[model samples]
Target: MKAFVIERYGKQEPLHLAEVPEPKLGEQDVLVRIHAASINPLDLKIRSGALKRILPLRLPLVLGNDLAGVVTQVGTKVQRFKPGDEVYARTDTRRIGTFAEFIAVAESNVALKPPSLSMAEAASIPLVGLTAWQALVEKGNLRKGQKVFIHAGSGGVGTLAIQLAKHLGASVATTTSSANVALVKSLGADIVIDYKKDDFAKTLRDYDLVLHSLGSEELEKSVGILKPGGQLITISGPADPEFAKNNGMPKLVQMIVGLLSRKIRKKAGKQGVGYSFLFMRGSGEQLSTLGELIHSGAIRPTVDRVFPFEETNEALAYVEGGRTRGKAVIQVVALANQA
Candidate 1:
């Protein structure tokens, strides 16, 4: 089988199309013939070795995170699916390789694709959907009539998070470029701040929660807008000690992470807000719930663009430049002469 792989981790390195051995199916796995795959900033970080100490992925790693595909085979213990089941998943980060013709994902991390979507559209949802679900519903426990600020309203996670926040009955606020103000509003954002024209933290206040996806400067300012006892969940780093401990990192690493987050934690403390870092994980059960929401039209996949499978590198470059309105997808298997 052919897969796009990186021989080494560097921002300057390009993905090479290489012929590799097929992935072996484990007892708890399902083999998928990928129809479409989505590129994520996580893939860029991994490719650049930004997460080397934490991830320690194998050399010659195939690159991709989200996949929508058809089940070609299932392992002995896999009970929920069989051959020909259409599915989508954000593959476990430990064994990510969706930029290929096939991937053997643990059955527990796969879910049936929403029937209302095309393969490329299905591929755009999993990672961003799971991230939104975990942050807004699971961690934030956002309630009706509450106000939640989601930074970067036009990015992959931002697009889904904005819509999901509104569906959960919370008033959503988000920041984006001037050109994207209308786009985020259509995604159900009640308050749209053009980050280029206005400082969101300076204008928005008394929020129940803030979903921070940017870096230290914005993370610092986000706390001021949250009311006392409100939560601030960040998908971007300076990983907190709790996350490090929960994920079983080395004691030294945990301590270093604690040090990394000390400033933000102390600031949130002074403002009487709760702060934690989120590294979204894969869960088939959660994906199922998201699929139902997508099917019902409560939330929709926002695909900014789709590239041919062989143009995976070009797709990555486009996303890396941060030009997308929603999410960018690589259509691995064309449908009905799709461009």
Candidate 2:
């Protein structure tokens, strides 16, 4: 099967389409014939070797994370899914490669695609949806009448997190450019700051939680905005020690990770704010819950573009340009064609 792979890791090295051996199916996995795959900033990080130290992998690695497809085969141990079931997933990070024509995902990480969404649309949900779910509901424990801030409100995760925060009954505040203030508002953001003109730290204060997806500068600013006993969960991070420990990192590496987040954690601690890093893991059950929200129209995908599978490289480049209004997905096979 033809798949996009990186022979070497570097910013200059581009993913090349090559004939790779088909994926091996495990007894607890389902073989999905991918109809669409979504591109994320995580793909860029891995392709450029930015995350190589934390997530070391062999070369000739395929690049992709979110996929929506049809199950062509099911392992003997798989009970919930079978051939012909339309499904979608953010495959486990350790085995990510949804950019290919087929991928065998563990049955526990796969969920039925929301019936109301097209494959391209559903492909945009998994990673971002899971990120938002874990940040707002599970980790943040956001409650009604509380305030929460989500950074980068127009990007892939930001678009979803804003809606999830709203759905959880919290008053949502988000930062976006002038072009997207209206967009975020439509997603239920109670306060939308034009990041280019105003500072979010000054605009929002005493928040119950903050879902952050930016760098050190934004991290510092986000931590200050939270009130006493508030929590800040960052997906883009200088991996904290707790995250390293939870992932079973070497003690030396964990020590280094702790040193990296020391200053910020100390700052948060002084203000009675809690800080932790969140690296979202795939879960079939969480996807199932999010699927209901998507299906019921409580949350909707904001897909900026649908590139053909052949244009996966272009799609990645577009996402790297940092001007997307929402997510982008590569359509590998068009299912139903709008019925």
Best by lDDT: 1
After TM-score superposition, the amount by which residue 137's alpha carbon in candidate 2 deviates from its true location, in angstroms, is 1.0
Question: Tens digits of per-residue lDDT for model 2 on 141-207?
Answer: 8898999999999999999998888888999888999989889999998898888899988777799
lDDT per model vs. reference: 0.92, 0.91
Q: How much does each candidate deviate from the true structure in C-alpha RMSD? A: 1.4, 1.3
Return the TM-score for candidate 2, rounded to 2 decimals.
0.98
User: Tens-digit lDDT track for model 1 on 1-339?
Assistant: 989999998996899998999999999999999999998988999999988877889999999988999999999999999999999998988999999999999999999999889999999999999999999999999899999999999999999999899889999999999999889999999989989889997899899999998888899999999999999999985888999899889999999999989999999999999999888888999999998888788899999999998999999999989878888999888886432
Task: Find the 10 residues in a row with the least total lDDT in model 2.
Answer: 330-339
Candidate 1: which stretches are off by over 4 Å? Answer: 336-339
